[model samples]
Target: MKIKVIKRRGFEEPFSIEKLEKSITNALKCAGIGLEEAPKVISKVLEILESRMVKEEVHASEISDTIELVFIQKAIRNPLWLNAAKCYVLYRIYSDAGKVPAKFSKTDLSLSFNALKVLESRYLLRDPKTGRFTETPDDMFKRVAYAIAEAEKRYGASESKVREYARKFYEIMSELKFIPNSPTLMNAGTPLGQLSACFVVPVADDLNGIFEALKITALIQKTGGGVGADFSELRPKGDVIETTGGVSSGPVSFMKIFDMATEVIKEGGKRRGANMGIMHIWHPDIEEFIMSKCGPEEVLKNFNISVAAYDSFMEAVIKDKKWPLVNPRKCPEIKNALGKEVLDIAIKCSEKGVEVKWVNAKHLFDKIVMCAWKTGDPGLVFIDEINRHNPTPKLGKIRSTNPCVTGDTRILTANGWVPIAKLFEEAKRRGVIAGIVEKEREISKLGEEKGYETEILVPYGEKLIPTKAVVWKIGLKNVCRVIFKEGFELKATPEHRVKLKQGPWVKVSELKEGDKVETYGLWIKEATVERVERLGEHMVYDLSVPGYGCYISEGILSHNCGEVPALSWESCNLG
Candidate 1:
């Protein structure tokens, strides 16, 4: 059967059922739809168009819409057919507006196909990995483009100008891609609205407060945010319970609840929630807090531990003395206070040996350095440093930093690095015994002034800087520990190498390129030495330690080198 209609432009167009069927079949075949399904859809569409009893003014849009209705009713899911339906609908609309040519020429088909492919590829079925996609509804594309084009045409703009604007608009839209954070991506712009990276809640000494903190922490974890708590405010261990007259279990016991909470409250059902458990040095159960993260199997696998070192404790360590390990509840004055006076008490406690084991400051410092050297964690946050640099110091002393020891700007302005030594010195200058500087001086002298001989091996492109304080063993397999002015120490192993000035000198093994090394024992790690230079008789190894400071190490010659026992060479014969 054939149906012919003269277009309004006087061009006669003939439509054959067989031809329509063939076109539909080809489109469906290209779309990967089965012929059996495609024929039924095509037949329904052809029947509607053939039965058109309307005037010649009937638009192609109407015809395309009818076909689309049939396909939709048949539940057609073919991407190609869906795109073709949209393109047909758009063409019909354009034809009704007299914008399309009367005769459906090869040029028209080619233009429509190209336009449809671009639209579909840009909007439909986005690639999951690359996030790019194919065409969307042709009507929608035309609608948006037509609005812009019409505006430009109204302004008397040339077609080229309108097209250039359209291209620019599309380019902008293409780049406006957003990847939300874990929580926001999972929930936000969705039904569940919880979105946060970290949450901090108070845990009072009461049952309600304790459970409340745990519940909130659990909820935050459910939405995929880690939690940290300052357990210092909790009552001390062995404190008389007013409610039950029994001894309080203290912060350590309460921490177990949080530990259990972390164990059960999985983050979005994927992994256990991470937590940060902090206790002040003065807490009665401070020992448990410090040792919590130690041992073969840490009790809380998801928790990072930190001991909030107060001013006095640091002072005592500087003075090579003992520190007081008073419970926060007993020493309420130390709660949110920052200054040298508060530090004096900690120093006095250290002298009395009442605090957590008063060993050499060097020992504790060594342990921390070693752990950081190994695991890159167990971060130290000098409480005094945090409080001093805190912009809101007037509000209250910053009791805790973030889990990573990177201070939160909301509480402390200098969130990245806090100058503890400067603050301590300032406190002393004000006639406050904030720190035992004299004691720190003695310890520094004892460590840095000692005749420590270390032989270092340098690989290719490596050099050694000699320090007046350090005695270098210019030979192979030599090892020595570097004691800094502040009681910080590091061990360097040097390799034997021949140099111009010295007959044979041991070059400390320069860390491989890209390896992180630290200097001045200042808690900074991962600094790389950029270049090495010589200063007169001593070699200056120019080094850069990330986030802390840069320094140079120098070698010292032994006075007894000339009188050293001579090695007698003995010839051995192979028998």
Candidate 2:
């Protein structure tokens, strides 16, 4: 056959049809395509090439694309033409792209052919009844594996290396087939791009602020963010209304809007939104707030409700004192009350049990603990603690923590508290200090008082004193000094002046006849000495040292020798 090669300035030289045919034959031979099929595939490609608008400078990429399209549409379905056509097209493209030629010299193509056969077996589908054809989902993976195996076999790649490549190809296929988490699988490659577990919104005092927050919350929830809000800032029920000249519904009434919002939002069009609603203890409608969580006419079952308690209220409970229930609107005075006034009201309430739904502080604490133990709901957060530790303490007091209290930044600016006390409690139980400042303070106090700094180690028991004297003598300096430093003025007791005139010590042998001694702030007559011996580092003197003494041991008297008398320590002066 005659051959013509074309060349143009600034372009790679192109070969004639005869030369292209020989090149295809060589590539097919290298890829192990049978000589019988190679010529037929090359002849068909030559026929298609004759119709192309021959350019002065021919780009191999353009030719490859055209050839691939032709093969896909015509030759791909025929098993006999498939491998040869693939080899010819791949060779032309690789030659143009400067990639390794798709040809084998000495290596056998059996492994590559077998790999392709496995792919075809798994991924080529035929209608069971009609015998029509279809490609299975695994077809793409199988094709990739077949291509890799063919390349490795032709290149004399190591068996281990070829197996490694095969394993990686399988892994890619497996991952493509596996299911992922909802957000990751849905939004990972999508445009909207919101992937989070929860969000918290703040309900402000004004209508614009409230509704705006609600709208944002709805938008977030619509995209699958669980939301919580603090409704405590809303004015109480029946409080003065400037806009409508009528009584305004309290936080509980407004909470219905949130509940309704949750119903409408629909998380990713799948589930209802979850929320937490909280109110402070000083709220005018706090009674309503507590009841809103329970009772037949409850408003928000979707929301977890909590009461924000301050430090003073918690302390009053610890002291078994009364606590006042002050309305934020009507009795705003009690909102920031402290010291004796708050304590007095609390105590009065405790006495009467009717001032404002009086319940024992411990009882309320137990209710909160028990409820959490049962349903894992109604979490508590120390509101004062939250505020004290808030980073932006200057902005405003934190009214509530978020639903989970995973953090506190939201609380400072959000004007709401959702009690995450259970979460905090859980963190504490795990020994993780969620509140760094609080934990530091506790550790500091413990560190300061760790050693021998005034500890009461003696167990409770009867004590005795000996040798009565006039007032103004017994060592009261240390006790008085401690009291004075503690900001307390000590009153003089009748026995404060009693003096230890002489010999507050007694020997084991010298203790005998009509002895009296003082031990543990009490005076007692001493009986006869029973026995004496050495115990470890100290001498054990068994003297009758103290009130109602009967066969007293030396160890007891010797260990307490600071208050023991001389010879008189042994005698029984029981009268």
Cα RMSD (Å) per model?
23.7, 29.2
**TM-score of every candidate:** 0.37, 0.34
What is the C-alpha lDDT profile of model 2 across 438-469, one tens digit per residue?
11122211111111100011111243212101
Best by TM-score: 1
lDDT of 1 by residue, 1-575 (tens): 54564443455576545645654555455445677876677678767766774543334334545666775554465445664554454444343334444333332243344444443333223334433322233223333443445457655788888877766644333333322244533343333455566655545556765786687678778877777776776877777777788988888778887888788878755457887766665565655556555546557666775666656666667777654455444444344344554555555545655443334544455555566565544556576665456554332223211000001101101122222222222323443111111222222111211112111211111332221111211211224333333333233333211121212332424323332333321344223333322211211111111111112232222111111111000000000
**In terms of lDDT, which candidate is strongest?**
1
Report the error of model 1 at residue 88, Å. 32
Candidate 1 is scored at a TM of 0.37
